[model samples]
Target: MPCDQDKLAIDDSRWQVAVAREAVIRPLINAGQLSPIDVATACRILGLRRSRLYALIEQYRSAPVTSSLAAARPGPKKGARRLAVEVEAAIEEAIRDKYLTRQKASVSTLHDHIRHLCRERGLDIPSWKAVRARVEQIDRFKLVRQREGNKAARDRLRPVPEEYRADHALQIVQIDHTRVDLFVVDTIYRLPIQRPWLTLAIDVASRIVVGFYLSLEAPSSASVALAIHHAVMPKAEWLLARGIELDWPVSGLPDIIHVDNAREFRARALARGAAEYGISLLHRPVATPHYGGHIERLIGTMMGAVHMLPGTTFSSISERGDYDPERHAVMTIEELERWLTLEIVGRYHNEVHSSLQMPPNAAWREALDRRRAPFRHPHDDQQFFYDFLPFEERSIRRDGVHIFGLRYWDDVLSPWAGRLDRQLRVKYDPRDLSCVFVEGPDGAHWPIRYADLRRPRITLGEHRLAQAALRQRGVRLTDEQLIFDTVEAQRELLETSASITKSARRQVARRARSLNAADQGAAAEVVAPGTKDEPETLPVLAVEEWS
Candidate 1:
């Protein structure tokens, strides 16, 4: 049929595209090469683009073989010619064995390595665009694995053999806290409330949660410390029942405690407790949830299992109670602890994990058996505590010290009034970022107020500058006078503008240095640094603002 005849017969304009499409597929059909499905797919892909081709094909279909459709203008050479075999080999080799290695290969790194190899072999290469095109042609880059089974398979596979022991199972345990919302009854308000707080510790090798606790409160330092105690210390009742003597200097104190910087986990008391237990605390970077993947994954599992419980909620009146939120509960703390110990933990240890192939309990027992000698628990009454909190050496300014260009202050810092210019270590909570604990050489810590820079307010330095401007105007300012009143008045008039002449001078100096370093070409392309968001303010007493 004629292409235009078929196009006219279809009332729906979209079907007209099929005429043009069929024209493109007609040549392959005449050659008796393509399958019926393949021709349809070709027509579907070509759609409107093949309209002219379809017309030409229909014209030639009824004519002699000499009336075959003319070939179009040639585009650039594609496919095999773009990607060379040599580049493909390197990328494949890098992925085969060293994929998870420390020096794993990346796309840019692969390109660089390929270029180096070409240079060594005395081959001239094309531009980076050409190299990328060539790499894509042969599927050299390992794109994201789209299969769900792949990640689960990777997780199930162990990096090393089970028998291989770095030491005891407890030598390097991982600890983390997660909030699990539970359906519980509120005794005070007589309503259902979301109760959250679940802290857990696992032996690194076996992946067994040796200690676990849950509550309707926010997790805190004491919660983590208690969890550790439950994992290491034999229960008093268990000791009494078995008639076994409890040993001291707990056997196999974890060498490292890996945890994310949750407020509860990053507390000074938690760090001190870990240090006392002879464990090195390792905290993950702020906001990076993937670092604590194991605990996070477990949280998902617990929520799936527990939150489905029927008819129990949190007590509403309990918020005003004297009890710490970190504590599990006053009335049911022991019962909850016992239930966790018996039900979730006990069942979890006995179940065979896909990763372990054997039960977690079996794997742990085997790991313990592989230990060269028996562990003797520590009996010493005294313990050493190391301050595991992160500290940065910073110079104090005003009543506040500038950390990362933001002001932080404490009312207790009045004693250090003279040492404002001196550098001191500022210890802070990596989690919340709300309170900074100021520490001295004696290792004493005092909690200080911390405000985010995003807050709308005048900084200490700006307030001082306003006070100075007002004092110069012969205004007798009282101690309680607002500093912003004087300073903000002439803020616009005091602003300094940048000059092109100064900028040119700096550019010239930079270029000269670049020339000295034999990087003249790079220096020419360099741009000057941008101005700060807020202008630099003169030094002032931070406490003065509060006064």
Candidate 2:
């Protein structure tokens, strides 16, 4: 019945009583009164009683009706008006000067410029949002004309062209400089700090870091050359002491040295070095990195290890002073060096490669075993870098050495390059054979006379000599053989180790579980069920109320 109220009201809307009640209510309200007759008529029209109508009106009146006929009022504080005078001035200046006209400048760029201007004037700049608001107030419909062209085309792909090898081992050693973030000790300051430098190296068959140079700056041709020397050199002194005497250069003279387009790699010194070693040098494309993928991967591996070192920061060694044992880990430089050579390198060589399926050392040894007898690592290419690469020592002149037209006079380099040709060693990277590095007596090496630095190119013929010396005692391999063997070895090692370790873990877990179950069962038998360990009971208190 209650739900039928709307239906009853609708039905009453068609009755004559409803029309009469609607017409009579206006006059009664004009008289500022509601008569019984009017109330009765309204009740009948609306399908309710007179008392109910009066009660409903009172109830609704007390139910809080909001005033709908009120005048509009302003909202809460609309916030302080921003100062756009400076922004307007800047925009006008930009427009007048043609620095920017029809094209709209980004809010961020505007903010940055405004901030820079404020900094120059020693004035505080407003927040970025305020700056943006000002810009919007001035010209919200501004359009920025963007230059259209292939950005990818601007950066040509320069990949190190891969050289074809016929066999495994040292067939084609790829060399590249990877900028690694690392902490180096500033010997002068005796503090630990972070520094980035060029890590140059050759990736032998097993992707081992056969040779590398860690410097505080981008590597020079000489640094690259030194890395090559290390690559060809015998195992580190510590490794040799530990009795790891196996013929190296096992694969052979790298028939081709692959490198990126860095000036060091293209230097004459490096080219001469490679030529002397009977190794052809190849340069990568302008921007493509995948051409020399192995060396790139090796760089990643090296940096990964570097990241694991503690207290590493992003700074230069010269700025922070020599690595402080107190600040860094408690390892001395010699100790750290030893660890790197013996532990890191040793582990790396011995670890089974995911791609090669064999340890680098194993692959190297196998290549050696397959080589021409006497099992001696070849010396044929050892002198290639060592002899042909030029080392010059130059002091920092009042005017720095003009390398490719740029003046590089770092305070650190100033101490070394101040003098004229003060006997610095300059070695070139073989890949490009156009750039040479100035090597200092303090073992600091960097690219010398880079094209950007405006250094004149020395003639290659001056350094060119016959590849007279063949490696009398090392294994030689074709490029193809090297890659196949190395890859096969890595794959084999990864799959084999995974399988063996997984099975061994499963067996050990199963055995341990069985032993645990048996022990539990035996222990259970010795324990008696339903032992008489009675629960403690509390005494009940008798309550008495005495009058």
Top model by TM-score, which number? 2
Which stretches in model 1 have alpha-carbon errors above 4 Å?
A: 1-168, 186-193, 236-252, 286-288, 311-336, 373-378, 381-547
User: Which tens-of-lDDT digit does each residue in 1-547 have in candidate 2?
Assistant: 0111111112222323323332333334434567777777666766776765565455323321111111122353123243466644654453333323434456777677777766675556767786655444342112222222234333343232356332445556788775544444432233443343545455555465566544433466756665666666554452565355533332234546778877778676576445433456777665676677787777666656655676443235674456552356333233344455554455777788777899777776675555442311334332233444554434456654432213344333466554544434444333222244454443334443332232222222111211111112243422323333443443345345533443332222222322332232211112112233222223445668999
Please write out the lDDT profile of model 1 over residues 1-547, one tens digit for every residue: 1112211112223333333333444445456555656555665666424455446556555421211232322453223143456655554444443332345455576667657766776656445676555444432112322222345434443133223223556655677776544433223222233444678777766666666645444565645654565555545443343343432112345556778766777565565445333355777655566666666655565555543344222233363245333232222332333445554445666778777799777777777776543442323211111133345767666657655334677556666755644466665432223345565433344555443333323333344455666678786633322443444454433322112233322222222222222221111122212322222223343553553
Position 458, candidate 1: lDDT: 38
The regions of model 2 sitting more than 4 angstroms off are: 1-166, 187-190, 196-200, 236-252, 313-335, 369-386, 391-547
What TM-score goes with each of the models?
Answer: 0.34, 0.38
